[model samples]
Target: MALFKRLAERQRPVLEFTLDGEPASGLLGDTLLTAVLTSGAHLRGSDFSAEPRAGFCLMGACQDCWVRLGDGRRVRACATALEAGQHVLREPGRRP
Candidate 1:
């Protein structure tokens, strides 16, 4: 169950990646957040609440879209571009 769906087909090439160790792919220019949500993956769970967060502001100012890359770097998903072979993961124990 994806949270989003593309409105129309585009010619951009798809880049392969992984989300939580599961195979996934995204359009070449997609932001990490866009890739994650559109794949039916949930954003990180809120630290203060029981609800899951889907990034309050699409921009990078909210500090709400942090996610870990496979290389162990934490990044703001909303501001990061999805790249080929990139691996994204929800911070451990933060599952919604």
Candidate 2:
């Protein structure tokens, strides 16, 4: 079917990234949280309300995908790329 073919064509090859300081490798097309959570490692982002977070919406619409970058900037993990050496942190302070 045309739809199936189109979907298949849109799928990109999996790229790898290191989560926190741990070695977490997964598809690049998937959001960073999705990759990290799928690997079964602890994450610190908006994906969860508890510690060691996870990914919720794969799209950028949800604010729960937030993360602090290596440069100390907070960004939505769902909207950012999973760079090979990126060090993303969860919101450090108490949730307001």
Candidate 3:
């Protein structure tokens, strides 16, 4: 079961994006972490152990939801909003 679920009967606008080269979508106003988690996707893998991590803290404190943008810039998934046509890489080593 998903931790996050849409409550409204009317669907909100969705933002289309690529997750590790696969097509994905999320509701507008959702943070990157929320989108990924709600989609049942892993946010990232730990750098040291290569174990998958979604996020520890939904806020910006845990530093567990870091992801790379299509341009290769790293950002905290929990702190970043989901944008239309955005692309994200879930693993640490993959670029864009």
- TM-scores for all predictions: 0.88, 0.58, 0.83
lDDT of 3 by residue, 28-71 (tens): 88899988877764678787777667789889998888899999
TM-score of 3: 0.83
The superposed Cα distance between candidate 3 and the true structure at residue 91, in angstroms, equals 2.1
Better of 1 and 2 by TM-score: 1
Q: Per-residue error at 25 for model 3, in Å? A: 0.3
What lDDT does model 1 reach? Answer: 0.84
Which is the winner by lDDT between candidate 1 and candidate 3? 1
TM-score for candidate 1, residues paired by index? 0.88
lDDT of 1 by residue, 1-92 (tens): 77878876667899889998998888988999988888864777776663667888989999988999989999999999999999898754
> How would the candidate models be sorted by TM-score, starting from the highest?
1, 3, 2
Listed per model in order, the count of residue pairs whose N, CA or C atoms clash below 3 Å is: 0, 1, 0
**Model 1, position 27: C-alpha lDDT score:** 96
* Comparing 2 and 3 on TM-score, the stronger one: 3
**What Cα-based lDDT does every candidate model obtain?**
0.84, 0.57, 0.82
Cα displacement (Å) at residue 10, model 3: 6.2
